[model samples]
Target chain A: MDTKLAMHTKNLNFFYGDFQALFDVSLDFGANEVTALIGPSGCGKSTLLRCLNRMNDLIPETRSEGEIYFRDQPIHGQEVDPVEVRRQVGMVFQKPNPFPKTIYENIAWGARINGYRGDMDELVETSLKKCALWDEVKEKLKQNALGLSGGQQQRLCIARTIAVEPDVILMDEPTSALDPISTAKIEDLITELRKRYTIIIVTHNMQQAGRVSEKTAFFLNGVIIEAGLTSDIFFNPKEERTEAYISGRFG
Target chain B: MSASYTGQKSYYGDGMAQNIARRRRHGRVWHILFYAATTISILALIVLLLNIFNAVFGFVLIEDEVPPTELAPGGDLESLSQGELISLLEEYLSVGLIRRFNFEEPLAERSVTDLAALVQVRIVNPTVIEAWSLQESLFQSDMIRAEHAAHPGTRVQFRSWLSARFLVSPQNPRPQLAGIRTAFFGSLWMIIIVIVVAFPIGVAAAIYLEEYARSEIWYNRIIEVNIYNLAGIPSIIFGLLGLAVFVRALEPFTSGTVFGGVDPTTANGRTIISAGLTLSLLILPIIIINSREAIKAVPSSLRESSYGLGATKWQTIWHHVLPASFDRILTGTILAISRAIGETAPLVVVGASTFITVDPKTLFSKFTTLPIQIYQWSARPQSQFRNVAAAAIVVLLVLMLSMNAVAIIMRNRISKQRRI
Candidate 1:
């Protein structure tokens, strides 16, 4: 099977004011594969994920000192617009942040922003269908996004991210706040999503990382400890720290 | 083991121990004190409100029917109660009483009874009546007959003073004859002009400072310091500044006097536009400060999300921030306007008169605000004008309270809509 790298990073270093957050991070997100970044809290996984789309540029004091290439083009190049970059590299936040708008508007927000002049109904329906939310929410698009259940809202956020027609999707702890049923549903959706788009997800759950991603990178204290196929990383991690963290001996 | 355990016991006392029990009692006492202080403040406010109502209503009932006691001449009104007072008043109305009382003219030609009629009316005694009758056989007119018919032989008191007539009557030079019509219209004109001039400017400045200016320290500091200082400035100072700038410097455009051959001083200095501009300046800072706060209060996450979706700064602010902050900004504006309406010192300093006979018709026309009129009436020599002043105050207070209530309702509606 021939697979291409959808996104690649080279020697990326990030700093928040005077404090360095991510040190010499380099990783590739494979096309049509789920890549899970597993780490304890404050281990730079989310920071590295944000660099893929230049979301860190929103913070005034945040500065990065390396190149991040997406589809072989430098994502952080001066020629690229941050707004355009965000449109092509859609993200779902840790918390389900549906805009305080109607469910229909929430799903349609990205399309409208990108000046989608086509039929909104078809686009919204297709996007919701892909997120597995069309049947559940088809009759209630007019209701406020805030009125939806947590699980529904997270799916709505995911649907919102996908509607922008991005090449890659970044989910930062997408199902961390959901119930067991909702988590299972999102895990299934992630597996299904691998058929279409490149997916990079940061997860705290070691089992979730093994179950969802084809490959897993375990990060600890702003450094990647191990990166390998998910089965190898789970069954026989080479690094002592990776084994200790995954086996619940140390976090 | 017993000795070590006893050492630990000193550090971590049991809940049933005396020290821990005492600490818990102290915490409870503090909580009780906090609640007591809050209740005491509320009780004090209630008592103050009850006292004011008692004093106000006590006088309202007693003075509702009498020809307001406040309007009666203070000491020995015997001369004012007599015959020639009506003719004296009528004559003074033609030439202008302000000039006569203040200028001391000769008795033959000087006709008007003067602005101090509450005291001056007593001069018309039976002796003066007999003298005036012999002197003026030429003044036998139906108007005189009607004036006699108007003065029924009822003794005037505080109770007979308040009538529907007081509300609609035009202001007279006499304290008893004075009404709120001119002052009411003056306040109306002032508010209209103020809103017209201030609202757009204040909102524009706020939008610029909050949305467009992104932390350029110098401009931000200037805006921050200016807003804070502006809010702190005594409003009357704005009145003085308005008198200097609008009344004196920009008088040509506002009063339209200096351009054509219009009499500059009469047309320029004491116009409604000047008063309104003064009030606008007085409230501008508050509007800007409150508006900025309202904008700031809108969650930054909302802005980030909008921008993340490729919305421009103006679009984000207009579509998201503005909708979210609309209620707060409106509430702030209403509060600022209410403050402007009740302000007396600045308007007083800017030369608002007490008793203008006619209502202000245009921006450049002569005007008198309610508070200034009340101030002038209260300073008169007669005690009877005091009642008139009180009644005027009641009207002004009612108007102000109603405006505040409307503002509160608007604020509630905005918040309720958001909540729903």
Candidate 2:
């Protein structure tokens, strides 16, 4: 494993008003590596993913305790702007939510707003190519993004996120709504993206976690049950609950 | 026991057939009821359209004091220049009437079109003694001819009350000469001001309430409830409010005195600007409620995605939320404007002039709207005025529908651009 740390959270606790959603949890993400957070429903995996770039701040009355460090700088500190954090750490949602704009504009909007002054046409093309969508969409760059198929739209979302040139990308169940073929394509894309970007994915599918990630963190009841190399977590027994969840005794 | 049960089932088979027959009969009854309701609604719309069309096209016995040919000696009345029309008016009309008209609006400065209309109205003085609906005019020509013959001095002519001249000429005491020009311009000015004043304020208020205001706050709840209640309040109440707030309190600003006066004598608060501001208040709640619904219709996921991409709240709303809901917001605006266009009670209470000959020259000019004009005409004792009033109603309907159609087309174009 690479020793370079991309991000880490220490003793992170999250609450929606008075209801606690995440307990004291500590996690580390390595640079240029894929880390998968796997758990059942309502285990705070998505909550933890949203905390990386402060996406949870949008919800009213949501508060977080402790600290999240991106490249060893405290992101949740008073002086830090969530907008700046989100610029460097982009995200892909569970469902493919493309802006109701042209395919070219959808990729260009985030980059343009984030102060990207380079050749926009080249940026759109490269981002699409990175998501393996350039050939299918290059002819109709001016068409509405919503016109794409489910898998194509998801890929376009990835293209849109990476267009801003972010260092880390957080994906919250990016393929849970997709079919088998689209899921496979996205998993392959994720592996390819790991070369240059730190990718953290929160997925419910166990086999997907084992297949795509180098490190796997198992979550149960708003707490981290186990965290280790994906191979070790899938094969070796460190926590009984992790084994029980993996072997399908219970979720 | 099993054999006895089988015997009983066979005995009730005839009864079961009877129940099935009754159920089928009830289903047919409900289907007929549904169809009848649809037919009644469509028939009502058709009847309304036919009624308006009946008044628009008709036959009238017109008794001209002086023929159009006699009025315009050298050239056709339609082709005469403003100077020629002015000379013709002076030659035909008595000096006292001409002086009175000149006092109101200097004929020398009026456009050729306005001069021609003045010549037709003041000099020719055509009187419609008798009028018939489109049906009677089309099918009972002999009856109309006999009626005109009995009148002796009148000639039966097929006249469409809704003429191109009817749209351009100003209101007159005579039904044959009255037109909706002044009221049309008044409505135009009022609607322009209403939309300008209400749209941005309404949309901003809606955005704040829907997106920024915390639902848990007591004041937000009160505001939300008040907005809903305001939308349902009778339009007449808005009229009273406009009268008190805009016409009375804000007289100086609305009358344009504070901004340097245009017409001092008539530029009281009872002007087009006051009427426009009043109507803005009238439609503000509607615009806010509808725009809130439009903003709410935007999926939450879109907002989340925007936020996740590092976009600020304003940027997300401007780039995604507003665009996504643009078509619906336009629909709401069109509806609100249409309501404002037809509104009469508020304008009446706010002091819309019953008779105004000159077109509104500025916001401070005293004004009348189509509904107010129609209302005044319909209130007159003459039957001919009622026919003219019906014709004005047709004009109003057409204007409202055309405005709505333009908005709908714009909305469709925007939606098509965003179509998936």
Each candidate's fnat, listed in order, reads 0.27, 0.81
Off by over 4 Å in 2: B1-31, B66-124, B138-146, B263-266
- For B1-420, candidate 1 gives per-residue lDDT tens digits of 223454653434354467777999999999999999999999997875543333222111111222323334553233343334444445434557634644675433433334234234333311101111211222444444444455553231223233566677778755445678888889889888878888778877888888777564687888778788988998878888988898778878768675555576567576888889899989998999889899989987677666656666677787788878888888888788888888899988777865577888777778988888778877887655665666677778778888889878888876665442
Q: Residue B312 of candidate 1: its Cα lDDT?
A: 64
* Cα deviation of A183, candidate 1, in Å: 2.0
lDDT of 2 by residue, B1-420 (tens): 323454653534546667888999999999999999999999999999898888878889988777787766653677887777888888877999889988999888888888887777677767898889999998998998789879875678888888887899899888888898998999999889999999999999999998999988999999999999998888888888888988889988888988985666666788898899889988999999999999999999999888878898899999989998989988998899999999999898999999999999988888999999999999999888878888899989989999999999999999988886
TM-score of each: 0.78, 0.89
lDDT of 2 by residue, A156-246 (tens): 9999999998899999999989999999999999999999999999998899998999999999988999998999999995999999998
TM-score of chain A of 2: 0.98
Where does candidate 1 chain B have its weakest 10-residue lDDT segment? Answer: B126-135
Q: For model 1, how does the per-residue alpha-carbon lDDT over A173-201 read when each residue is reduced to its tens digit? A: 99999998999989999988889888999
lDDT of 2: 0.90
